[model samples]
Target: MIIVPASADTERGRPGTTQQFADMQAYNDQMLRAGVFVDGQGLHPTSRGARVTWADGEWSVTDGPFAEAKELIAGFTIIEVSSREEAIEWLKKWPASCAPDPGQHLELRQVYAPEDFGEEFTAELREREEQMREEAARAAARG
Candidate 1:
């Protein structure tokens, strides 16, 4: 399974507070019931954020109250699904509400697991991971 996190554009997201919250709650409940949701959240406006960079043993921090809507991430979700098609199917229902404008976009990406590292280290890592999971399952059953 892969987990994907997505966000809406700051400029074109939910416009009505009461209706939006209701719609979002309903959508979240549906996904949770279907066991497709791993975790998710909405974010505060961009003005409450900051940016930092590090290079060559030095660090720089910028005060953001970001000026651009495109620089902000409005919300995110982690979903478990079988394939990219399935992931897109899930994403198609996102935003949970109609956008105030037409430019909203959701970014989809696959979460990396040990197996994505390829045959070299992945083979051994996957075996170890399976063993760990089995052990954890046995421990949970005992408890």
Candidate 2:
């Protein structure tokens, strides 16, 4: 998962230009052709969202637009690669299409598979997870 930390445009609720979308689509198409791109999407600004927090056994809700732009996520992309280096190589190609600014940065994170948790992720858990995923796929297909 590549996390796109928030930018000024996201905080300000500014929309991207048509050319930016076209450029990104071209890059995404290339990745799709290479069989690396699995999924990707952009998010609306924080002004339309909310946060629910649990702390000290208490629950609280905070409405946006949130103040901390750097901590928010404006978008994300998921890719499958054999190594971190390969992921970085793909990341390097992103900026060319993204029209990034000097302050813009992205975070690369590996998604955790059930195997990563070792025995703590028991067989029962894996089975349940697989069942859920299948159900989700079926629901999507129905739609």
Candidate 3:
């Protein structure tokens, strides 16, 4: 996940520039060519973000930019790699996408697939996933 670290823009707007946009596309192209890229995104600044919480049979709403700098995730990138070490190496290659002023950060995270759910996932679940994947492939081929 790419985290836009806290700065003045948290409240009203997000960060962007033509140079950074070009840089991101360049980096994404590299990853796509390598076949490790799954998906990625950029988020609007916090002020346009929201939080939903539930407790005591009630729900609460909070708008961003949230004050807690560390908690916010500005964007995310999903990739498939052989190992955490490999992911780290790929993440390390992220081009500096920030403007000279507002800083940028990236967090590499392991996404849990059904296998991570252990025994509870069951053979039926695996079969369903496999069937879906096949369907998607067929649809893609048709398109």
Candidate 4:
């Protein structure tokens, strides 16, 4: 997962230019051609979203815009690559104009596969997980 955090300009609800979006689309196309792009999406600003938090054995919903811009995610990209280095190489090609100014950063996090959990993750569990994923894909396709 490539986590795009909200920048200062993003927190202010600044929108990307048409050219920037075109550039980003081109970048995404390139990644798709390279067979590394699994899925990706850009997000609207924090003002249009909400957060749900659990505290003191209860749940609370808070409306945006959230005060901590840096802690908020603006978007995400999921890539399928053989190595971390390959993923970083793809990240390096991110379109500069597509993101906000002043400060911008993307975080990389590895998604855990069932194998990563070792023997405790039983074969039945793995099979069930795979089935669930297949069902989800089918549902999405139907939609």
Pairwise TM-score winner, candidates 2 and 4: 2
lDDT of 3 by residue, 1-143 (tens): 33334445533454566787788788889989999888887667777778999988999999766776656666677888888888888777776755323444566668778889999889999899889989999998999
Q: Give the local distance difference test score of model 1.
A: 0.65
Candidate 3, after superposition: displacement of residue 54 in Å? 1.6
Pairs in clash, predicted candidate 3: none
The candidate scoring highest on lDDT is 2
Question: Candidate 3: lDDT of 101?
Answer: 31
User: Per-residue lDDT tens digits of candidate 1, residues 27-133?
Assistant: 77888998888877776555556788898899988875566655356666788877889888876775456333346466787788776777776667788988998
Residue 66's lDDT within candidate 2 is: 90
lDDT of each: 0.65, 0.85, 0.72, 0.84
Candidate 3 regions exceeding 4 Å error are: 1-7, 99-105, 126-143
Candidate 1 stretches with Cα past 4 Å from truth are 1-16, 95-100, 118-143
Candidate 2 vs candidate 3: which has greater lDDT? 2
lDDT of 4 by residue, 1-143 (tens): 89888776666676566897799889989999999888988778888888899999999998888887768887888999999999999889989876544565788999898889999999999999999999999999999
Candidate 3 local accuracy as lDDT?
0.72
- TM per candidate comes to 0.67, 0.93, 0.75, 0.88
Clashes of each: 0, 0, 0, 0
Compared with the true structure, what per-residue lDDT tens digits does model 2 show for residues 1-143? 99887778866776466787888888889999999999999998999999999999999999889987768898899999999999999988984646445676878999998899999899999999999999999999999
